[model samples]
Target: MSHHRSPPSPPPPEPPESPSSVYCTPSPQSKATTPSPTARFFLSRHQSFIKPSPLTKHILPRQQSSNTLPPEFPYEHDTAKTSVGLYLRKHRRTNPAIWCSAIICLIFSILFIFIVVAILIIFLVVKPKTPVLDTSHATLNVIYFDSPGYFNGDFTFIANFSNPNKKLNVRFEHAVMQLYFEDGLIATQSIQPFSQRRKETGVVVIRFVSSLVSMSSNHARELQKQVMSNKVFYSVRGTFKVRASLGAIHFSYWLHGQCELQMSSPPSGSLMARTCKTKR
Candidate 1:
């Protein structure tokens, strides 16, 4: 009798199992498929991701900030596009004193060289001329002795100077006399005079008896020995001051001359021939 009881309503068909109920069982595959919190955050920021294999979950549509740079960005290319390059370019174009100073120095050196050359040329082209004056007559006699007996036998010289240039003025400061024997210089004498005039005949007597003997003995022993054995030729030089008045103009004169020395012996009573020729 119970078997016919509505087939027992088929136990309510156990209400067909829901899809959630079937998937509710703890499975390693389902747990592995779930994304981690870190991975989800990374996908949100990048917007895109890719997975090459089943072990990896890749987000798609990666995103980037317009102002932010990536880890692999090129720094050298970025710097060239910024303001730093423009500043360096502008600084090199201005500033010129360095070049200007070099040019100015070169010009000054050339000018200095030209000035020196011009001075040398002027000196080479100009020369001074000597003036001529009137002449007079004069005589000079120089004697040489061996025994220092003539005029006290000491080495002595007599000068008879006459100025023929009557129209000029002359001033003499230092008068030097050089005596020469056959070998070399035998004696020298210096004299100072107050003054003299043009057309004036003056006598400058120089006595070199002891001084000449001593000097010749020290420097030229051969000359002294020759003088002792034979007569020696000597020369005399004189310098004087003269002033000449031609109209209202006054001029100065310098006189130089040479004379022969004739030797004579008193004790032996023999006169030697002239050994020295006058040099003008």
Candidate 2:
């Protein structure tokens, strides 16, 4: 009713083209394409799977070998620290005592050696001696007498010797008494002492006698005549030598003396009294 004319009579239906003609047909140009939202999401997910992230690229893989060292290296560091501390503590404890003992021993050794050397030098270099001529006074006395049968006069001699040393130690080796007649030597005799001591006097005694006889023959008569005509006098001379030692000192001394003799005749004898004088 609405004047709707039937839609223009339906156009004639198009026929299908031949296969050779379809190959020659030109395609239409497409509009600028925009990916759908769902398609775009799918494409982004795929790209993420193909490419790696920045953080993952920068990181390096862990080494598989056990030879690699750890970052801290705790074992070597602890050993070095422990050794240093022990050395310091030990040095602090013993150093002072060791040095002090060494110094004390050195000083004592030096002192001992010095004392020994000094004593040796003193004994080797010094020499010692004692006093000589210790005897101060001496005296001699001689007496002469004539006997009936003896041709020469009998004489007795005595000697007194004194030591002045306060602590005297004297030794007498030998002593001799020589008697002279006028200017000629007559006789000699040895004197012996009884005792010796310090600050004391020593006494010596000697006796001498002569034996001679005159015969009636010519030679013996001539000898008697010559002897009777000669003048006779008496004198005494003697030497005394002594050696003494005390401690480490040694002493030696020599003494000489001379004296005259007095001769007296007995009541029944013909010889007269006379005094003999010493020559020197």
Candidate 3:
């Protein structure tokens, strides 16, 4: 009833194409011209592995150069530091005691020079003077000769000690007198110690008596001749140790004196003529 007559017979199946058809066969020209994706990928990966990185190329030369060179000293960097190092090395070789002793000796030398200069200046400014001494008078009291070689005589003498300095005082430490008959020493005497002010003179008195002295034959004859001639010759020598003081400054000296006497007296207590000389 539906009348649908069987659907129109299904369409007939299409026929298989032949191997030589354009749609069924691959083109050899296209296959030979273009590379495969797998091959292209492999080549790109090989190139990436072989090439060096930019960072590595820059750093490698610096490392190699640093490793090859010798190590450098640190002190060569600054001139000031090098000089300081050298200075320290020099001082390290010297002993500290040596430096200290050198400084002390230099100081003492300066001080000694200063003291000497000061003393010289003081001497120039002071204008100091030396003292003087002299014999003032001499007298022959008596003269007598008994027997062949026995002689007796008496004499008196006076000495004058004077201080010439205007600002100094003098002290006589010792005074000695010797009576000489030609080259023979007959008698010696000492005087008392005394002090004299500046520009002052002190007097010393002495008396001597000769004992019965034995004389040589020649001396006795000479003396007799002198007595007959009414003249006698004698010598007096003296030594004095004196110290001069002015404030804190003090000086000492030895004084010597020689005096000659010629007396025209016989058994009298008076002098005829005398002469004196002194040295300091």
Candidate 4:
């Protein structure tokens, strides 16, 4: 039988969209596939604002670290690089001042040593000599006896100081002269300071008077016997402070001398018959 099937009822019309479905479902795509300029700018901004998570040091790959550093770099790591930089900076600040002071001290020491060596060499080569001293005979200017045992006399003497060094100068500060008769002080004389040129001679004249000098009884008797026999004896002691100089170098010396005099007759006129013995 050709039964006319009623047309399948049209599918039920879709229900109006619910509020929950509208929020959960995706929007329909536009026919244009490429994103717009505004959308691209917004995506780039979002990516830039997002922060990356930290990398764990223990899990870092060795190859990645090696690739990041240049092969010719001296330090192995950041910490080592920082330490070397700090050491270099500190040394640069302090080393110059220290080195300057050390160099100055070394130079001064060398100069002082050189000066001392030069002085020693000059002294060895020079070989300077001390001055020479000579004494002439003394003459009696006046002689008198106030009492039997009291004897007095005025005597004149000459001293010759000669510098033997050809290139050295000599200075005599002072001279102390003492006259003795049988170990008793009879007179004393002092001379002023003077300077002598190289290989030059200086003359000093001294006059001393003995006043109220008493002799021992034995001495008086001996003196009387000597007077009758025309023989008399006297002693003189002298000390001189002298300085010898050769250029800048100078040295001091004490010149000591002892002399004995013998007179065979009383001194008269301009000359005296006397003999003198002297020692340096």
How does each model score on TM-score? 0.34, 0.35, 0.56, 0.52
Please state the error at residue 80 of candidate 2 in Å: 70
- Model 4: lDDT of residue 35: 71
Maximum-lDDT candidate: 3
For model 2, the superposed segments whose C-alpha errors exceed 4 Å read 1-151, 192-195, 213-233, 266-280
For model 3, residues 1-280, the per-residue Cα lDDT tens digits are 5665666788899887687864545589978987799988998999889977888788677745553323364445465567779988884468899999999999999999987875575468755455555565677766677777777777887877777777778888998888777655656789888999988987888777777777777887876687788787878888988887767767678888877777666665344566776678
Q: How close is candidate 2 to the true structure, as a TM-score?
A: 0.35
Report residue 189 deviation for candidate 3 (angstroms): 0.8
Could you report the Cα RMSD, in angstroms, for every candidate shown?
A: 21.3, 33.2, 27.0, 21.7
Model 1: how far is 249 from its true place, Å?
A: 4.9
Q: Which regions of candidate 4 are displaced past 4 Å?
A: 1-123, 267-280
What does the lDDT read for residue 215 in candidate 4? 78
* Superposed Cα deviation of residue 92, candidate 2 (Å): 55
TM-score rank order? 3, 4, 2, 1
Model 4 lowest lDDT segment of ten: 269-278
Expressed as tens digits, the lDDT of each residue in 200-242 for candidate 4 is 9878887878888887777777766765666667677788888
- Scored against the true structure, residue 77 in model 3 reaches a CA lDDT of 46
Top TM-score: which candidate number?
Answer: 3
